[model samples]
Target: MPHTGHHLRAVFRRPDFRRLLSARLTFQGADGVFQAGLTGTILFNPDRQTSAMAIALGFAVLLLPYSLIGPFAGVLLDRWSRRNVLIIANIVRAAVVPAVAAMIWVGIAAEAFLPLVLIVVGGTRLVSAAVSAALPHVVDEKELVTANSFISTAGGLAYAVGIAAAMGLRPLFGASDHGYAIIALMSVLGYVGTALVIRKFTPNELGPDDVPDSGGVSVARLAWHELRTGAQHLAARKNAAGALLVVVGMRVFFGAALIAVVLLYRNYFTADGFFRTHETGLGQIMFASAAGNLIAAGITPAATRLFGTRQWLGMLLPLAAAAQLGLGILFTMPGLIAASFLVAIASQGARLVAETTLQTECADEYRGRVFSVFDTLFNACLVLGLVAGAAFLPETGKSYAALIVISVGYGLLAAGYLWLSRGSTLPVMPAKPKTEPAQALTQLR
Candidate 1:
């Protein structure tokens, strides 16, 4: 196999791949800015009282409704032009951010605040699903793992950069609602940029390629049939299905850990030395995780090549479990930060493999629906984890019980994934068709 650098270069040589990646980085960065600003206002603002239940409720309000819509969105992706989806979704998000910012500005009721934010959040999810489904169109099958790593890692880094930029600008903007509102407004630039970049592609450039006929069916019934068809297709691909299950389990664990960390920073830890404030401490932890993601992006392609996709994923799940037990149990700032770094590496690495598996195994026509299912399950499980953590964890977020449960869950999930993946063969790149010397020479050129 060629060096990872060579694979990256080959992938980047494709024009559509670069364009799609540009759009992904832009909107995901916007997502980071929007999310960081929103969290700062809801969780860290001194004027408001935040608790575990409030946090859980906030997640449910933001995620569950959109998750319900996710499958329908998937069906639409299959029927409609995905290029239009990306363009329109970003435009809707750009329009929605100011409304959210305005709500924050006017001190809108939580009831009003959450629903409006949900629109923006839901749009972001839609764009993400579309992007994942569209990726296979731009890159060759042989380069899928490397291509996934590049996009995932780069997009994650873009998100982290957006967060860091928001945090840095927070002091300048002030930690008040007005400041967060301004920060929220900053995301509009990213949204607009993404929309413009996606416009460069033709309508069918990123595609379902073949759309199933609706044939005189009612809209509602058609959607249901399409969704069911997508589900049945996924069910038949056991490797892809198993990868999704592992992803769901990992999201649950990560979600609970996130809630615990947020509470710890808000209520448990005190300011000292580098941890000048709770918000600062949380930012540091986020940066640490981002760093781990960066490292994973660099190493995962090689790791997967060495161990095979399923085996590497199997190794990562246990590593996450060990990180929780060995480091997270300490419950100190440094301990949590270090633990977060390792957990991030494991999480990002596993996701890279899972994404490749889905893209490789599932047919293009079903890809959109399958990914939408993936998105729905991903968010729904995260919300489940948040709610569960809130029910059991204290105000201070210290709970040996919660930590132990999460760790044990990871261990069991690892065992289950390994068993589920048994006898699944590794994906092999197709050999290039033979060509005449003149044609081959021309292609090389």
Candidate 2:
């Protein structure tokens, strides 16, 4: 059974993929819609700058707690059933949404933004971490690329739809007290759907590592051992380390660059400028990026095959760096907007394929902890970038010289990763249980 293009298409047609896709799209889309409403409602209010900052502070507060706890959650995922975790996580989200809604309705949102948003953001990130870490347990490694591609496509759809809906619903709802409530309802529905679909999914049973450590080891000692073990496992794998470094470094630059883009957009376009007039420019950009994601999803299998290991990673990293550079240069050019959009598509598409493939290669027992490490570092770098970018915020007119300089730094790092790993083979993990059909089918049965 070789994976011809016909076979690939049939792979996409699998019932599991469809259900998972639905769950991803719904969860991501609901997130998008909710954020849209939240940001739209807050930004539209003239007296909310301080409140907005408070909300941001809430995000910062949640960041460390979320990141620090993720690895342990991953350990739990390894030991416990992923299906149950996903279902429970969604239920938790559903419960939180209405609480947020109530706060908004009572005019306490601006006052209690910190605590409320902290709980929401932290909880959401933890759930997402658990679900993502658990993906390899559901799909076979042979199907990893295909499964992740579908996930990225669904994410793209969610991003585009969420932005558009947010923009449209703002005017419809008048960005009033009820706006947040509507978003909460959407989140509730999405969570419910996610929980339902998860119920139908049969996850791979936990291996011995998934069992809770009960040999009289204290929780603190277990946590320390798990962290150390996870780190050792990842560090020992040269290929995984290389891929992780590239992603981690790129996220640092990307996080800063993203914040820079936001500031630049606010300065250059604002709600009163191009976006307010057309209203669709943001969506256009998002849709263009989504199109790129879709294209990436379609071509990823072939690209992964043709590019192999080093070449594929090489091409994507530099391509992403170049895209960021292009964005820096064309930050304000309306004509270059489409190019900018495509650049985002290319970067995100490539990263999704490359990163997930790398993560899926790790052993399942260590997978959660390893992924949590990636998530923690990636997120920490992002926050660092945002903070750094804020320092570089232009006080005057439109000048992207600073961004151009930063992009160059990122480009060099990307090139360095390629150079460092030059002699390496594709590093494709050939030890998957599926390769042993007798064992694989036995597990399936």
> Model 1: what TM-score?
0.94
Best by TM-score: 1
Worst 10 residues of 2 by lDDT: 436-445
lDDT of 1 by residue, 218-314 (tens): 8678888888988987677666677678878888888888899989988888887776447778889888898888888787778766766677777
What lDDT does each candidate get? 0.83, 0.60
What are the per-model numbers of colliding residue pairs? 0, 2
lDDT of 2 by residue, 343-430 (tens): 5554665566555654455566766676666777777766766566655656322446666766676678667867877776553322
Can you tell me which runs of candidate 2 are displaced by over 4 Å?
1-7, 50-59, 109-111, 202-212, 270-281, 333-336, 395-397, 427-445
RMSD of each: 5.0, 4.9
Error of 1 at 20 (Å): 1.1
> Which stretches of candidate 1 lie above 4 Å from their native place?
427-445
Estimate TM-scores for all models: 0.94, 0.85
lDDT of 2: 0.60
